[model samples]
Target: MNNNNRVFLVDDDTDFRESMQWLLTSAGYDVVSASSATEFMEIYQGEQGCLLLDVRMPGINGLALQQLLQEKNVQLPIILISGHGDIPMAVNAIKAGD
Candidate 1:
């Protein structure tokens, strides 16, 4: 893998976030995480990589953040993970070009 390989992980669940951090790090990808969409937006700098987002967060949620990123012209690939009831929202996000 390239040294620039990175994954931006945004989720409200601490356990899940940490777990994913470990997994991704073990897989040799540089991993960065934020506890919420707001936090992620605050720190993101349009770096080239993938975004791993949780669909059901407290403040902005994943889909809304995706839309915001689109508005800002971010073109990074996004992988949205949702719970059982949030599958539809995830699909909609994907359709919206997340």
Candidate 2:
């Protein structure tokens, strides 16, 4: 299958990741999920896609991952999701474009 337009999901919650995978799949998106940023990095091969990332995780949190991606010049678009995020976090995410 073509790699373009695939959706890369990175989150620590199994249930949330599965649910989002199901939802995105049901909507006809090609979905690839990983339990963490490290796992995602292992599987990703510079494919053209958008990322659905969790903001708070055990290691290499969303912001840190975003910075890492920036440093590597990865061009995939990222959407940061957080259930417990506050105003400051949201502001920071917006400013960081993640």
Candidate 3:
């Protein structure tokens, strides 16, 4: 994929967030990490490019966040990552709605 302008990442896992933040930043992609859906939304508003969203989180999950994005008419490309337990939900989320 082309080098995007930015990547908004939201996950409650601090270690994972930090690691991925480091990796993406080192790769020269402007990266922002969020610990919850609210944080993601805040960052999303400021982002100029794509997004990387985690499926499970406290205070509103990725699926719900995706819905919120749609309702807000956000057109950014979003990549979703989820644990095994969230697989079915994630699949449904990817297929079923906006």
Best model per lDDT: 2
Model 1: residues with Cα > 4 Å off, grouped in runs: 1-4, 85-87
Question: Of the candidates numbered 1 and 2, which has the greater TM-score value?
Answer: 2
Candidate 3 lDDT over residue span 1-98, tens digit each: 44466888888999999998999889888887889988766655544677788877888988788888888878878888876655567678778454
**Order of models, best TM-score first:** 2, 1, 3
Question: After best superposition, candidate 2 residue 92: deviation in angstroms?
Answer: 1.2
Candidates' RMSD to native: 1.9, 1.4, 2.9
| lDDT per residue as tens, model 1, 1-98 | 56368899999999989999999999989998999999998999878899999988999988899899899889979988877546566568769992
**Model 3 bad stretches (over 4 Å):** 1-3, 85-87, 96-98
Better TM-score candidate (2, 3): 2
Number of colliding residue pairs in model 2: 0
Q: Model 1 residue 87 lDDT?
A: 58
Per-residue lDDT over 17-70 for candidate 2, one digit per residue giving the tens place of the 0 to 100 score: 999999999998999999999999999999998999999999999989998898
Cα TM-score per model = 0.90, 0.93, 0.82
TM-score winner among the candidates? 2
